[model samples]
Target: MDGQDEVSAREQHFHSQVRETTICFLLFAVLYVASYFIITRYKRKSDEHEDEDAVVNRISLFLSTFTLAVSAGAVLLLPLSIVSNEVLLSFPQSYYIQWLNGSLIHGLWNLASLFSNLCLFVLMPFAFFFLESEGFAGLKKILEDLDEQMYMITLEEEALQRRLNGLSPSVECDLLDLEQELQNVKTLKAKLERRRKASAWERNLVYPAVMVLLLFETAMSVLLVACNVLCLLVDETAMPQGSRGPGIGHASLSAFGFVGAALEIILIFYLMVSSVVGFYSLRFFGDFIPKKDDTTMTKIIGNCVSILVLSSALPVMSRTLGITRFDLLGDFGRFNWLGNFYIVLSYNLLFAIVTTLCLVRKFTSAVREELLKALGLRKLRLSSAPREPDSAKPSANGHQKAL
Candidate 1:
């Protein structure tokens, strides 16, 4: 009788899971079509001179923004599904499985949270920094250069004037050259100043949401780190074992969801690497807003490497913290690392080694410059459009509505 009861329960569970999956698929399809229709309605014509690059950038932008618009909402809503960190980044199986897992909300939340973290912490700040300091050094540096030139020019002019006799031909020529150069520098400086004033609004456009999401991500990271530490310190006898089976939430992801998740990771990796390089070369922050369309393939290639590197990582870290349920991964979530070695490798050793190397290379001028050169080449491909176009306004408006 007990055997029959268990079998019956399993059947019921699977049935519900499939039903929920069906509904989710329908919902996704509806949303996808609606988004496409809306975007097409607002789509504007491109420039005559606009190359393949603009087409690619526009496509990439729309696809990514549409997905992230979904995720931004998910980060706000689906976090309510979280019950405990006892599971470490996931809710317990069987407890909230029907809602969070059957429909894949928990996984979405996890994925969304990661992306939200990157946007709030890295990209948002970097965007502000980019506007403040692009094209011809910066306002302060330009001012200093302009002042130095004027001072030198004045000194030369006065020295020539002080000559006991009327100025020599060479002295007069020298003063003329200095004055002309100073006038040129002043003109350039004035134009740069006007540019800064124009972009002042963007610099001040710091969204409050950035800080809120940053706090959330920081807290989550600290929790995971702390949970892993406890796992290390607490004897196995003291800590409770994980409940339910592997992949309680993971399940099999659809192609759409997979693409969305991959995009999430790619965005994170690109921003991280680019921000680091920009800081290194310009000794300041890097551009976060889509720079150029030419770099599409480059980002894809770099992100592929990042995916492989972090592929086995975050999941195993969740394992170390003893996640009682899987969240975002699909079929890939079926495998969980119960052993300690994988945990150390994923959570501890990877960061340690990478940090050490970064630190070493950071102080070494030659290696640091070389790293910048290689990264800069990739950055060069992404040469940003002079400025976002007026026609993009409708798309941006649509995104605002979606968000």
Candidate 2:
């Protein structure tokens, strides 16, 4: 009887644990959804039509301040989280110190989780603005210069044709000028090609960075929701023997939650592939847009497409991810170094690398050339001057050949 009672008690305890986990997970899922609506609906409103110097609206100001505070708090908590870990915060043998160490770990873990969750609200929106604003001005200047060169090439071609058609003495006198015009055209074309390449390179870097962060956030949101739903269903089955089985409605909830999670995961993967395709398409076909009349429309369309791709994923993302928590030292019985690594990599390292690479490719010609070469791409090289007559070549019978 005691053995049976112990088994029953164990089952009851298991169900209780499942219930608590499910509750926490559900709360996280709800927060994730709420964050999506709050950010997408309200945060974007903050960016619309406000002057640089204008007094900030209350909603905008509150969100901005909140975002800044969360980000700052996350940064500040990192050191404390590290030092407070059981392995690092070790003290000489004392009951009080041991208790303090455990308390610190518990406190830091929760604090880090809170900050991490709050940080998500800022990351996605911040990335959109960061990438767009950073690249737009420089990219616009490059495009303008490219358009100017195309105009000059047209004029220079006409002048060359007129010079060629003129009477012998008149044309002959201006032959050198015609050659100079041709050279100018060649130079301008080269510059335009270089600029186009730079633009393409920047586009490659910026697109990936933005997409990765957005996807990561979305995946986390959906996963959390799925896990929550799963736990709740498990909790029902884990009930004590005398308890009633889960109702049909509970089963349906499990099914829908699971289906929703799977669909979201699939969608995020599709978005990633689409982002790559879109970036390449823009880079290659962008020049096909008429430089004179429709450039602005092309830019607007491009931005819309990007926004659409990102926004489409927001629903699933909000359902899944929220705050990230990592226990680096196995204090929580698992070494979550990978999770911590991902947080650092996704949020900090990757952004810096992508931004820096794009800026470098845009500004430095030599570096651009090297990058293209390394990637095995061929750049347009200027044609070399014709070689002198083969008389300069070794004579067929060199010994006695006359000049």
Candidate 3:
């Protein structure tokens, strides 16, 4: 296409991309508002219960609601990105050629766009996982507190029962309200313990799985960035003589295509390895530790490993065997339907693994309380120790009790 025509097309593409981005931003805003509302509603409803467990449940519900909103936002933006790609095609041929010529300006713009798009995908999942992890952590704390509270109430009830039994019939009637309150507290405590167990299981499994996936995603992101840089290098080298500008090169087109293809292959391999590792980690370490704290150092190490492994593989894949796009496509063609089938199968497997981990954790937690009871570790009152029998004498008059 002529220079003028290319410029016109580029303008159109730019406008289209802008429109798509605006739509995406608007959708994100709407989703944020919805998330806030849902969390607020859950909190309000949860606050009505006076028990400690009820409070924890409310927090968990709020976190879950927020996560759902964030996930919805991410899914909504995926379509917007697809639409943006379509819009980019409307640019003029000359404008596109200029942009692809590897000028510093074009390179910077491309990098910015790539990172922005990646963030769009990564943010939602990160938010969902964060909320989930925090909710589970909160549930554990609440349950522990409830357990303590129940123990205290139980002890107080025992002591009060002894006193009531010792009292005259007329005096016992006066203590009925206190007795009823203690009973209600005991019931609430039991319910809380059950809920706590269930929530702990979810937290244990979900948090680790999410962390693994995030690490994989981080690696994928580095590979994507490397691919974009490689594509830019190839474009510069393959430019025709007459079209060559200050920043463009006159390298062999075949060599450029070969390098690009190699990079893509390395990317796919890294993705496969990452998927496997993520699946395995979740399955093996899905149990909750009572004192589990957020491991910032582990996260940092995981991210670094992901980057190094993927990045290191890139040069070896690109330079050693020199596989070109034609070669790669031919390899895939041999498998025919299996290629696409495997792609879908891999995704399904990952999903199944994650789901199973979640279910197992949930099941284990369901029986945790019963198991504890069977082990003679049933809830005990914090203050249940026997009081030293009346070290001070009882009041001479029955109307006054001893200190």
Candidate 4:
């Protein structure tokens, strides 16, 4: 009978774990589906005449805002569930009915808490960073378009110079016409510059949220770090192992959490500062040079490299190649690392590193040019040669005549 009871208890525990895991998975699915529908609506509602690029920017911005709200709210609600679990179990339950009632409430709280943390710390942060990156791409595209336009203007100017030197009777008129066209292009370029500046200013809307989240995360990380330090001090004092508050074992766990949080914070700051400065410099200079599009594929590739390096690749490589292996990874590779609490922290660190590296690479300029050659724009030298005859030069409207 004793053996049978033990077996039954084990079965019950296994079943309970399975149910909770399924519930958490389903909750995540539902949240993701909802976000999908929300983003789809924004895409469909965009105006028909709007530039495709503008519509894309709108969708990306909306997605990021929604992600930020959901992530912050979920993290904030984590404490409530934790409190319910600890406090509800201790309630006096002499009656079977009372015990069942408490158990149901506890279960519900756990489910809610689990869902919130998954959304907040994992899905939402990833989405937020992704959208921020899209914003950078949009700005970059605008700058490229500006460059192409300038190059075209330069080409027209060069052709006009050729006409003026060909001895054509219409050389004087061609010069006048080409100068007018160049002035018009310059005016349009000025308007584009203003638009770029406005877009940069609009990007500032995200700054407040970024700063707030950073501060909150920093506080949590500091608290955890302090806890881990206290634990280490207790261990060093050689007190009774059991009596040491947050014993060495628990302190080690705390230390792991601290490291994860600290890494996450560093990556986030790196992205925010780097992106802000990089984008600002691009806007300030108004340099128009063709650049490769840093599309979604590039971002994914960059993120994979970052995650591999920071999480597994570098650590494993060092261990295998070096003479010594340290406790650098903490408890990250263990089964407990998959626990809800552990995963929530782990995802943040992973996403931060990936997103930061990807954004930095996205903003890095690979090409530089002072003239827009692709758009037929090249620097021209003034020639004092005889003017072109009328039949060999362009018309007053800037259209070249048939030879």
Full-model lDDT for every candidate: 0.44, 0.43, 0.42, 0.42
- lDDT order, best first, reads 1, 2, 3, 4
RMSD of each: 24.0, 20.7, 24.7, 23.3
Rate residue 165 of model 4 by lDDT: 89
lDDT by residue (30-125, candidate 1, tens digit) is: 655664454344333331123443444344444533443433343223122232222323344455444544345544444445554564455434
Q: What residue pairs are clashing in model 2?
A: 117-323, 220-320, 220-321, 221-320, 221-321, 222-320, 222-321
Superposed model 3: Cα runs more than 4 Å off: 1-18, 33-155, 162-164, 168-403
Candidate 2 residues 155-272, lDDT tens each? 9998888768872356665798889999999999999999999888766675445545554544554444344334334553321111132311122222344454344444445434
User: What shift in Å separates residue 154 of candidate 3 from its native position after superposition?
Assistant: 7.8
TM-score of each: 0.33, 0.22, 0.25, 0.27
Clashes of each: 1, 7, 10, 9
Q: Which residue pairs in candidate 3 have backbone atoms (N, alpha carbon, C) closer than 3 angstroms, thus clashing?
A: 6-92, 6-93, 6-94, 9-91, 9-92, 10-91, 10-92, 151-380, 151-381, 151-382
